[model samples]
Target: MRTIRIPYAELPANARAAVEAHTGPALKADSASEGLNSEIAVRLVSRTGEYYVKGRRASHRWAWTQRREAEVNPFIRGIAPALIARVESAGWDLLIFEAVDGHHADYRPGSPDLPKVVDVIRRLGQLPCPTIELRHAEQRLERYVDRPEDVAYFAGDTLLHTDWNNTNVLVAGDRALVVDWGWATKGAPWLDAAFWVIWLIASGHEPASAEQWAAQVPAWQGATVEGIDAFAVANAHMWDEIGGHDPDSWTARMVDAARRWRDHRKA
Candidate 1:
């Protein structure tokens, strides 16, 4: 479910003060059209310039997500919007970012943007996994693996975004900037390419065509068929639980796409 957005004025006085202390008084505050996990998704116009502000009460589950984004932003520099500042006050946690002058990435077949997306994925896979503690993909995929031993297949030290929905990527100039690092994981190098397959399928590619695109990435080429199969099965099951069999929901459709990919590989 989407978090309910709140107006900048509606935030507690201390929270607003914390922000103004950094950006000078806000000249304008407009609700942002993007972002689903933040309660405060607004673009604030300060004397300095434009900034995207995101926040939620510290007690909310997504509050942890805010912290993760803040922790990982600096490390993901070239692929993410610059982290301008971070603040906490009035029991709310927040992240302020340099707003990107780009739109969500286009993943449709034949779009010129597709090559940039692949390049970003390839570049991200090359960075050694940061030393900070990250949720291991094996642990995250545990419940869905058909065989208990298959969980080990996801283990690796590569840094992975894990979620590849087009909304999390922005196409800017000649590059695709990856945004929203909350679900970042340290896992198999092939994991990011695997996640992108479902997104390509959702964007109108057949399962085989999506895999063909994924194969262009070196990491995907290195992945064992058995390991990739397990990842697909786990992801399909995970979304099934999230969407609860709702056929019309995007999550449910992704669940089907993941299954189709798994079946295609089996064939």
Candidate 2:
């Protein structure tokens, strides 16, 4: 794959100044891919200490994403990385956070951490959030749906991560911390739960084991087979909008898995 380079010089003057101010002269900086957002990582060296910097070029609505996270970070401390500072200037938003230590979890099917991953997500769903309204399949469908009733049956009320994939989670010291809160919103918690379920199964877990893991989460406990089916459909539609590699294949697999689960339940 060709390396994509960002036009860092195009950043507004204030944003550039902020970057320089945080990382004094003789600092090493590198850009990292953050999927939906324009992101860069800077490594600073100073007499005081060394720290990592993350800067994201913001859209008009970019500040809200970080600000909202700032509000929630304290409450969910330990479950996510600590938020250090956020800078908003001239159509750009920069956020400095404590660098999470550890590599991304290898999320193939039947990975040892799959159950733990499900548990962490369920815990996130249960966290107290007074301000943000969680979104469900219906809301996501409305925003990204191409056809009516495309996501009709999957709607529910729960705080959802919206995007739950292997790349977004960091595993450190036997704990799984979810990162990239940019897509988080209030909605059916199961939407996020189901999203991960499909991921786990596709990564290579047997259907029975994946279903067992899914059932352990309160958000998915007692969830009918049909409910999971609807979630699969809605999730596939949402994934299409994100346009990842081999989306068609992944979507087909999710659909097939959902159908198989439904058929097994009927039998």
Stretches > 4 Å off in candidate 2:
1-13, 19-26, 33-36, 41-52, 60-64, 133-137, 142-157, 240-267
Which pairs of residues collide in candidate 1? none
**Worst-scoring 10-residue span by lDDT in model 1:** 244-253
Candidate 2 per-residue C-alpha lDDT over 118-218 given as tens digits, one digit per residue, 9 for 90 to 100: 76887887887545533345765665444566455555555567656676787887788887676566655566666676666667766567667777778
- Clash count (model 2, backbone only): 13
- Regions of candidate 1 where Cα sits further than 4 Å from its true position: none
TM-score of 2: 0.74
RMSD to native, candidate 1? 1.4
Q: Candidate 1 on 1-267: residue-level lDDT in tens?
A: 778888888999999889878877999989877767678888899888888888889999767778888888878888789988889999999888987788788889898888998999999998877777688999999999889999888998899998888988999899999988888998889889999999999888999899888988899987898898888888878877777745657666787787787778778
Give model 1's TM-score versus the native structure: 0.95
Per-candidate TM equals 0.95, 0.74
